[model samples]
Target: MPFIDIKVIAGVFTPEEKQKMVEEVSEAVIAVEGEALRPVTHVVITETPSGAWAIGGKALTAEDVQTKRAA
Candidate 1:
């Protein structure tokens, strides 16, 4: 059996979008592996506040990008 796990940041995708993504991912997995017993796939989405996530130790937000562009 093949097991797949996908983790993505929350809020970026809606429930319906998430479902579609999961389905597509599962199908891709099946395609790679021949039709055997059964395959297991898991998708985990996590949500974080604007300041909770950071890159290079600096938090990034929509406003930050806009401000940088304006400057």
Candidate 2:
């Protein structure tokens, strides 16, 4: 069994996008660990409220994450 935990800034990703991520991530794990683990694999996505996530001592918001992704 494998556990994949992901966290992103709140409002940064849509529900559809998250589902896509889950699918692709599961496939990737299956490819490595074998298909038998598919049912046991877990991919968890969590969101941190704006200003609740930080890096380098500075809190970051959804806009900050979007801007960084665009760069």
Candidate 3:
């Protein structure tokens, strides 16, 4: 079985978008691993809570992103 894990900050994607990502990721895996492994491919997406995902030693929330975008 093939297992894939994807992680991202919360509020970044809607449910439909996440589903699309799963489908597309599975397709990509199938392309690389061949058609036979398509049925066994698994994709897991994890969403970190807002203000919990950090970079550059700073934790960032969805509000921070919105403020930056407005600037």
Question: Across residues 14-46, which tens digit of lDDT does each residue of candidate 1 receive?
Answer: 689768877887778777775562345444455
| Local lDDT at 70 for model 1 | 67
Residues 1-71, model 2: lDDT tens digits: 79999888898898998999999999999999998999999999988999999899999999998898889
Q: Candidate 3 overall Cα lDDT vs. reference?
A: 0.87
Per-candidate local distance difference test: 0.62, 0.93, 0.87
Top TM-score prediction, candidate number: 2
Clashes of each: 0, 0, 0
* Clash pairs, model 1 backbone: none
Candidate 1 residue spans exceeding 4 A from truth: 37-39, 46-50, 60-71
What lDDT would candidate 2 get against the real structure? 0.93
Instruction: Rank all candidate structures by their TM-score, best first, as comma-separated numbers.
Output: 2, 3, 1
TM per candidate: 0.56, 0.91, 0.82
Give the per-residue Cα lDDT of candidate 3 at 54: 88
